[model samples]
Target: MSYEKRPDGRNFDELRPIEAKVGVIKNAVGSASFKIGKTWALAAVYGPRELHPKFLQDPAKGRLRCNYNMMPFSGTGDRIRPGGNRRAKEISMVTEKSLMPVLDLKNYPNTVVDVFIELPQTDAGSRCAGICAASMALADAGFVMKDLVSAVAVGRVDDKIVVDLDYQEEAYEDGPVADIPIAMLPRTKEVTLLQMDGEISKEQMAEALELAKKSVDEIYEFQKKALKEKYTGEQNE
Candidate 1:
């Protein structure tokens, strides 16, 4: 028996509801939290300060490091062990690449800009959510950026392409499948990060790209609202 799809009958181009909150952690230099459906991510940015070790320093530019980790209870069944793993490392590396283009690294010189993303829920498209949260945190940190980066994921399941896969959809797929995660600078329409997993035909890839672009636009609006609220509170003081 086949399971019924979700309500709203959203088309391939539609995105799940998104919510963003800024300054969630007062102690961090900057912090932001966001959720897309059941998937949630929180990001914190720290420092344009001195590098940790002599060997790690870069004379030409500041270093930007990212750490992406999933909470033990993020998934439904088994829990993940805390610390670096292959998947976590890959996500962190991708996140670092995504933000490097937007940041004004030269301005910071030998300093380091560190970003940490924590996923407290497991669902499809969490990587994209991580990127979105990290970008917002960086913005809250008052770092100069060319434009805000927004991200989204698109995938195919049950012969129907979809935007923002949920946890179950990602797990039990059959036949050819595709998952594309993208990070783009919304204002400039520049792509800083792109990753695809599984196999997809060229036509399907094109369709997914279109859907991701639309999703990113929606996410950008949500992020802007959260940032405005954070700044407004500061102004009122």
Candidate 2:
């Protein structure tokens, strides 16, 4: 089987059209929505506020907490409970790790930064889209950061490496391979989160990382454009 088969006639490194919006929710301190192909996610940021007594608090710097959940009808095949399960918890942790590196946590002491991600549609790259949305929401909240963070997923299908896998592609592909999801600080080109599933040769891994880095660069542009539009609207009023 050839992993290099092109779906939708896009090149190996090509990304689906990305649409992003900020401040979609009126109540949240900040919010953003992002779509990659059919996968859609909304992220909200609320805080640099007091932490609950039961939750762990950071003494030296503000704490970052993340929650990720999918709506019951998000996937095509079946509905899921609209709450955090083990997978959601793990994704949240990974997202937090991905975002922390870019945050200036010490700037806001004795507080907590809460990020929530809601997926209304599921595709292979939803996790990456969620991370991008969260980063934009934090920026909308007026949080200072070193640089914007963005994520993308690269997968091996039929012996070819592809960037931003869709649900259909991910499900049917076969091979000894790797699916690498990565978050990066765009300005500094620093990695904040990295996760991989399956096995690949060293050469293949290197190629995937190269593809991921390029994808991040593309995502950063989309993030900037989305942020500009949000603030532009506010300023015009």
Candidate 3:
């Protein structure tokens, strides 16, 4: 298959090497560790427990909240400060939203399911990775859901559409690189999360969506495989 040339010497349609595993944390209900090239993200799921402050609890459905963070040494740059900043807060919100639609919250009732995501390594598609890892962790946690959400980043570079851009590739252009992150429920083909940093023509947007869908398909497979590996082992014992 013909592919667009990329600065990282990868085909435009190709994703960086990805490896993921679930249940890395023994005590946590669910946990996952994932890496895309050098960038990595870890996620852990806790509770479906009582909601703090009580008033925030919804009696009819459970709550899903995400806390996304970047470790100071995650980036190649100098030691970064730890704690929430504007960027971290925004990403946490989006990441939470991306995974919300797929959860069958009503059954949970008055409890909150907290998903904590950390980017131990910074890269262009960290948010997408966070979503993917969180989903895996949730599945490992044994929640009822329509489907595990799959995510990927789509970018326009040198007039070519690319999947899974790295840090340098994401910073390639000044204008809208069309840095878009999308999350989808593969079975229903429903979009759970979408964010665009730059604008593109209608045609490019269509191409981007198509590209994202295909990329998500691959991601979903990995997620499923990771979950199966975890539960299958437990069943054997």
Winning candidate number (TM-score): 2
Q: Which ten residues in a row have the lowest lDDT in candidate 2?
A: 169-178
Candidate 1 displacement at residue 132 in angstroms? 0.3
Q: Report, for every candidate in turn, its global Cα lDDT versus the true structure.
A: 0.84, 0.86, 0.86
Residues 62-89, candidate 3, lDDT per residue (tens digit)?
A: 9998999999999877886999999999
The runs of at least 3 residues in candidate 1 whose Cα sits more than 4 Å from the true structure, single-residue gaps closed, are 1-10, 234-237
The digit string of per-residue lDDT tens for model 2 on 1-237 reads: 666566677888999989988989889999999999889999999987898783577778999999999889998887887677999999999999888888888976778889989999987788899999999999999988778899999877767888987877777645555677888887777888888887777787788888888899999999998899875775233
Query: How many clashes (backbone N, Cα, C below 3 Å) per candidate?
Result: 0, 5, 0
- List runs of model 2 lying over 4 Å from the truth: 234-237
TM agreement with the true structure for every prediction: 0.92, 0.93, 0.93
- Higher-ranked by lDDT: 1 or 3: 3
